[model samples]
Target: MSCCSPEGHCSSAETAAVPAPGTTTVYTVTGMTCGHCEKAVGTAVSALDGVTAVQVDVTAGLVTVVSTADPDDARVRDAVEDAGYELAGRATAAAH
Candidate 1:
Protein backbone atom coordinates (compact mmCIF):
# COMPACT_ATOMS: atom_id res chain seq x y z
CA MET A 1 0.00 0.00 0.00
CA SER A 2 1.09 3.53 -0.58
CA CYS A 3 2.40 5.46 2.38
CA CYS A 4 -0.38 7.98 2.13
CA SER A 5 -3.81 7.33 0.72
CA PRO A 6 -5.33 9.26 -2.14
CA GLU A 7 -7.00 11.53 0.38
CA GLY A 8 -3.58 12.45 1.67
CA HIS A 9 -4.23 10.60 4.89
CA CYS A 10 -2.10 7.79 6.15
CA SER A 11 -4.10 4.61 6.44
CA SER A 12 -3.94 2.27 9.39
CA ALA A 13 -2.92 -0.61 7.18
CA GLU A 14 -0.10 1.41 5.71
CA THR A 15 1.01 2.62 9.09
CA ALA A 16 0.93 -0.90 10.51
CA ALA A 17 3.34 -2.06 7.88
CA VAL A 18 6.76 -0.80 8.83
CA PRO A 19 7.89 1.72 6.30
CA ALA A 20 11.45 1.72 5.08
CA PRO A 21 13.77 3.60 7.34
CA GLY A 22 14.28 7.19 6.28
CA THR A 23 17.81 8.46 6.48
CA THR A 24 18.35 11.86 8.03
CA THR A 25 20.87 14.02 6.24
CA VAL A 26 22.27 17.33 7.25
CA TYR A 27 24.05 19.85 5.05
CA THR A 28 25.91 22.99 5.87
CA VAL A 29 24.34 25.41 3.46
CA THR A 30 26.37 28.57 3.05
CA GLY A 31 25.37 31.93 1.57
CA MET A 32 21.96 31.77 3.20
CA THR A 33 21.45 35.18 4.74
CA CYS A 34 17.74 35.11 5.54
CA GLY A 35 14.51 33.16 5.64
CA HIS A 36 14.27 33.22 1.87
CA CYS A 37 17.61 31.54 1.63
CA GLU A 38 16.41 28.82 3.94
CA LYS A 39 13.26 28.39 1.92
CA ALA A 40 15.26 28.12 -1.27
CA VAL A 41 17.50 25.49 0.23
CA GLY A 42 14.47 23.55 1.49
CA THR A 43 12.73 23.78 -1.85
CA ALA A 44 15.73 22.54 -3.72
CA VAL A 45 16.30 19.60 -1.40
CA SER A 46 12.62 18.69 -1.34
CA ALA A 47 12.58 18.59 -5.12
CA LEU A 48 15.17 15.86 -5.27
CA ASP A 49 14.06 12.37 -6.23
CA GLY A 50 13.16 10.28 -3.17
CA VAL A 51 13.29 13.22 -0.79
CA THR A 52 10.48 12.79 1.69
CA ALA A 53 10.85 15.95 3.77
CA VAL A 54 13.16 18.87 4.42
CA GLN A 55 13.74 21.12 7.43
CA VAL A 56 16.07 24.03 7.77
CA ASP A 57 17.37 25.96 10.76
CA VAL A 58 18.75 29.22 9.63
CA THR A 59 20.49 30.03 12.87
CA ALA A 60 22.28 26.73 12.82
CA GLY A 61 22.97 26.99 9.13
CA LEU A 62 21.70 23.47 8.94
CA VAL A 63 19.51 21.77 6.37
CA THR A 64 18.09 18.35 7.03
CA VAL A 65 16.35 16.00 4.67
CA VAL A 66 14.63 12.69 5.21
CA SER A 67 14.52 10.21 2.37
CA THR A 68 13.97 6.52 1.72
CA ALA A 69 16.52 6.33 -1.07
CA ASP A 70 20.12 6.11 -0.03
CA PRO A 71 21.21 9.67 0.73
CA ASP A 72 23.54 10.68 -2.06
CA ASP A 73 25.89 13.35 -0.78
CA ALA A 74 26.74 14.44 -4.29
CA ARG A 75 23.08 14.79 -5.20
CA VAL A 76 22.38 16.78 -2.04
CA ARG A 77 25.37 18.97 -2.72
CA ASP A 78 24.24 19.55 -6.24
CA ALA A 79 20.80 20.51 -5.08
CA VAL A 80 22.23 23.09 -2.69
CA GLU A 81 24.51 24.36 -5.42
CA ASP A 82 21.63 24.65 -7.81
CA ALA A 83 19.81 26.72 -5.24
CA GLY A 84 22.77 29.15 -5.27
CA TYR A 85 24.26 27.97 -2.00
CA GLU A 86 27.43 26.11 -1.19
CA LEU A 87 27.15 22.75 0.55
CA ALA A 88 29.71 21.74 3.14
CA GLY A 89 31.01 18.21 3.73
CA ARG A 90 28.77 15.20 4.38
CA ALA A 91 26.22 15.62 7.14
CA THR A 92 27.26 15.06 10.71
CA ALA A 93 25.89 12.07 12.64
CA ALA A 94 24.36 14.14 15.42
CA ALA A 95 22.64 16.36 12.93
CA HIS A 96 21.20 13.27 11.34
Candidate 2:
Protein backbone atom coordinates (compact mmCIF):
# COMPACT_ATOMS: atom_id res chain seq x y z
CA MET A 1 0.00 0.00 0.00
CA SER A 2 1.04 3.62 -0.55
CA CYS A 3 1.47 6.32 2.13
CA CYS A 4 0.25 9.44 0.47
CA SER A 5 -1.73 12.03 2.38
CA PRO A 6 -5.05 13.36 1.08
CA GLU A 7 -3.41 16.37 -0.58
CA GLY A 8 -2.02 14.39 -3.50
CA HIS A 9 1.41 13.81 -2.11
CA CYS A 10 3.40 10.56 -2.31
CA SER A 11 3.53 8.96 1.08
CA SER A 12 6.59 7.71 2.86
CA ALA A 13 4.90 4.49 3.84
CA GLU A 14 6.55 1.94 1.54
CA THR A 15 10.02 3.29 2.45
CA ALA A 16 11.72 6.36 3.87
CA ALA A 17 15.19 7.57 4.75
CA VAL A 18 15.93 10.06 7.52
CA PRO A 19 19.33 11.56 6.69
CA ALA A 20 20.18 12.84 10.13
CA PRO A 21 23.51 11.84 11.60
CA GLY A 22 22.04 9.08 13.76
CA THR A 23 18.69 8.43 12.15
CA THR A 24 18.99 5.94 9.33
CA THR A 25 17.41 2.61 10.12
CA VAL A 26 14.29 0.77 9.03
CA TYR A 27 11.85 -1.43 10.92
CA THR A 28 8.90 -3.65 10.07
CA VAL A 29 5.75 -3.12 12.13
CA THR A 30 2.42 -4.89 12.44
CA GLY A 31 -1.09 -4.49 13.89
CA MET A 32 -2.22 -1.21 12.45
CA THR A 33 -5.74 -0.55 11.16
CA CYS A 34 -6.68 3.10 10.56
CA GLY A 35 -5.03 6.52 10.52
CA HIS A 36 -5.34 6.67 14.27
CA CYS A 37 -3.20 3.56 14.53
CA GLU A 38 -0.68 5.09 12.20
CA LYS A 39 -0.56 8.26 14.29
CA ALA A 40 -0.13 6.24 17.44
CA VAL A 41 2.70 4.21 15.95
CA GLY A 42 4.38 7.30 14.59
CA THR A 43 4.09 9.09 17.88
CA ALA A 44 5.58 6.21 19.82
CA VAL A 45 8.49 5.80 17.44
CA SER A 46 9.13 9.50 17.08
CA ALA A 47 9.30 10.00 20.84
CA LEU A 48 12.65 8.25 21.01
CA ASP A 49 15.59 10.66 21.11
CA GLY A 50 17.37 9.41 18.03
CA VAL A 51 14.35 8.75 15.94
CA THR A 52 14.01 11.36 13.23
CA ALA A 53 11.32 10.11 10.90
CA VAL A 54 8.65 7.42 10.89
CA GLN A 55 6.48 5.95 8.15
CA VAL A 56 3.55 3.67 8.76
CA ASP A 57 1.23 1.80 6.43
CA VAL A 58 -1.97 0.62 8.08
CA THR A 59 -3.00 -1.41 5.04
CA ALA A 60 0.41 -3.05 4.70
CA GLY A 61 0.67 -3.57 8.44
CA LEU A 62 4.22 -2.27 8.56
CA VAL A 63 6.25 0.50 10.16
CA THR A 64 9.58 1.88 9.06
CA VAL A 65 11.85 4.23 10.91
CA VAL A 66 15.18 6.02 10.85
CA SER A 67 17.07 6.84 14.00
CA THR A 68 20.44 8.23 14.98
CA ALA A 69 21.03 5.92 17.87
CA ASP A 70 21.89 2.26 17.53
CA PRO A 71 18.95 0.18 16.44
CA ASP A 72 16.82 -0.50 19.48
CA ASP A 73 14.23 -3.00 18.46
CA ALA A 74 13.13 -3.54 22.02
CA ARG A 75 12.40 0.11 22.60
CA VAL A 76 10.73 0.31 19.26
CA ARG A 77 8.61 -2.72 20.00
CA ASP A 78 7.82 -1.40 23.43
CA ALA A 79 6.75 1.89 21.95
CA VAL A 80 4.45 0.12 19.51
CA GLU A 81 2.99 -1.97 22.26
CA ASP A 82 2.55 1.12 24.37
CA ALA A 83 0.59 2.59 21.53
CA GLY A 84 -1.70 -0.44 21.70
CA TYR A 85 -0.23 -2.45 18.84
CA GLU A 86 2.00 -5.49 18.29
CA LEU A 87 5.43 -5.65 16.69
CA ALA A 88 4.87 -9.00 15.01
CA GLY A 89 8.66 -9.52 14.46
CA ARG A 90 12.15 -8.14 14.85
CA ALA A 91 12.93 -4.90 13.04
CA THR A 92 16.10 -5.14 10.97
CA ALA A 93 17.38 -2.23 8.98
CA ALA A 94 17.64 -2.62 5.24
CA ALA A 95 20.59 -0.22 5.37
CA HIS A 96 22.04 -1.33 8.67
Candidate 3:
Protein backbone atom coordinates (compact mmCIF):
# COMPACT_ATOMS: atom_id res chain seq x y z
CA MET A 1 0.00 0.00 0.00
CA SER A 2 1.22 3.46 -0.76
CA CYS A 3 1.75 5.94 2.02
CA CYS A 4 -0.59 8.39 0.40
CA SER A 5 -4.12 9.62 0.81
CA PRO A 6 -7.06 9.08 -1.50
CA GLU A 7 -6.32 12.45 -3.02
CA GLY A 8 -2.92 11.17 -4.11
CA HIS A 9 -1.01 13.36 -1.73
CA CYS A 10 1.95 11.52 -0.26
CA SER A 11 3.12 12.17 3.24
CA SER A 12 6.74 13.17 3.73
CA ALA A 13 9.33 13.78 6.43
CA GLU A 14 11.04 17.03 5.39
CA THR A 15 14.36 17.97 6.86
CA ALA A 16 15.30 21.61 6.65
CA ALA A 17 18.97 20.76 6.95
CA VAL A 18 21.26 18.32 8.67
CA PRO A 19 19.93 18.47 12.17
CA ALA A 20 22.25 20.37 14.45
CA PRO A 21 22.95 19.06 17.91
CA GLY A 22 19.54 19.73 19.36
CA THR A 23 16.42 18.44 21.00
CA THR A 24 13.65 16.55 19.30
CA THR A 25 10.06 17.07 20.28
CA VAL A 26 6.87 15.58 18.92
CA TYR A 27 3.67 17.51 18.93
CA THR A 28 0.16 16.27 18.30
CA VAL A 29 -1.75 18.15 15.62
CA THR A 30 -5.28 17.91 14.28
CA GLY A 31 -7.00 18.35 10.89
CA MET A 32 -4.14 17.11 8.79
CA THR A 33 -5.75 14.77 6.28
CA CYS A 34 -3.27 14.71 3.39
CA GLY A 35 0.15 15.59 2.05
CA HIS A 36 -0.73 19.21 1.52
CA CYS A 37 -1.54 19.39 5.17
CA GLU A 38 1.77 17.80 5.92
CA LYS A 39 3.67 20.29 3.78
CA ALA A 40 1.80 23.23 5.18
CA VAL A 41 2.50 22.28 8.74
CA GLY A 42 6.05 21.30 7.99
CA THR A 43 6.83 24.57 6.24
CA ALA A 44 5.38 26.63 9.02
CA VAL A 45 7.22 24.84 11.77
CA SER A 46 10.44 24.69 9.79
CA ALA A 47 10.41 28.46 9.61
CA LEU A 48 10.95 28.70 13.35
CA ASP A 49 14.31 30.10 14.38
CA GLY A 50 15.83 26.90 15.71
CA VAL A 51 14.01 24.21 13.77
CA THR A 52 16.20 21.92 11.74
CA ALA A 53 13.69 19.30 10.65
CA VAL A 54 10.01 18.55 10.63
CA GLN A 55 8.36 15.21 10.11
CA VAL A 56 4.65 15.15 9.66
CA ASP A 57 2.75 11.92 10.03
CA VAL A 58 -0.74 12.76 8.90
CA THR A 59 -2.01 9.29 9.62
CA ALA A 60 -0.71 9.72 13.15
CA GLY A 61 -1.43 13.44 13.60
CA LEU A 62 2.09 13.82 14.88
CA VAL A 63 4.78 16.35 13.96
CA THR A 64 8.29 15.55 15.01
CA VAL A 65 10.53 18.59 15.19
CA VAL A 66 14.26 18.82 15.65
CA SER A 67 15.64 22.11 16.80
CA THR A 68 18.79 23.67 18.19
CA ALA A 69 17.06 24.09 21.54
CA ASP A 70 13.90 23.14 23.32
CA PRO A 71 11.44 24.98 21.11
CA ASP A 72 8.97 27.40 22.59
CA ASP A 73 5.64 25.66 22.70
CA ALA A 74 3.76 28.89 22.13
CA ARG A 75 5.72 29.56 18.96
CA VAL A 76 5.13 26.05 17.70
CA ARG A 77 1.44 26.37 18.46
CA ASP A 78 1.22 29.66 16.60
CA ALA A 79 2.96 28.21 13.58
CA VAL A 80 0.54 25.31 13.45
CA GLU A 81 -2.42 27.63 13.79
CA ASP A 82 -1.04 29.83 11.05
CA ALA A 83 -0.84 26.78 8.85
CA GLY A 84 -4.58 26.37 9.38
CA TYR A 85 -4.30 23.47 11.79
CA GLU A 86 -4.61 23.02 15.50
CA LEU A 87 -1.67 22.11 17.66
CA ALA A 88 -3.01 19.72 20.22
CA GLY A 89 0.06 20.37 22.33
CA ARG A 90 3.04 18.10 22.74
CA ALA A 91 2.55 14.43 22.20
CA THR A 92 1.97 12.53 25.40
CA ALA A 93 3.64 9.22 26.18
CA ALA A 94 0.43 7.39 25.34
CA ALA A 95 0.22 9.14 21.95
CA HIS A 96 3.47 7.63 20.82
Q: Whose TM-score is greatest here?
A: 3
Q: Which regions of candidate 1 fall more than 4 Å away from where they truly are?
A: 1-21, 94-96
| TM-score versus the correct structure, for each prediction | 0.70, 0.66, 0.80
lDDT of 3 at 76: 99
- The per-model lDDT (C-alpha) reads 0.71, 0.69, 0.85
Candidate 1, residues 15-81, lDDT tens digits: the string is 1122345976667776765656766787898899988888777666778777986688899999999
Give the per-residue lDDT digits (tens) of candidate 3, residues 1-96: 433777776755443443546798999999887777888899999999989888888888999899988999999999999999999999998886
Q: Give the TM-score ranking, best first.
A: 3, 1, 2
Measured by TM-score, how close is model 1 to the native structure? 0.70
Question: Please, what are the lDDT tens digits per residue for candidate 2 over residues 1-96?
Answer: 434457646433333444455545555566665666778788888898778788776766767676766667888889989998888764454422
Q: Where does candidate 1 clash, by residue pair?
A: none
* Clash-forming residue pairs, model 2: 3-11, 22-67, 22-68, 23-67, 23-68, 29-63
Q: Least lDDT summed over 10 consecutive residues: which range in candidate 1?
A: 10-19
Indicate whether candidate 2 or candidate 3 has the larger TM-score: 3
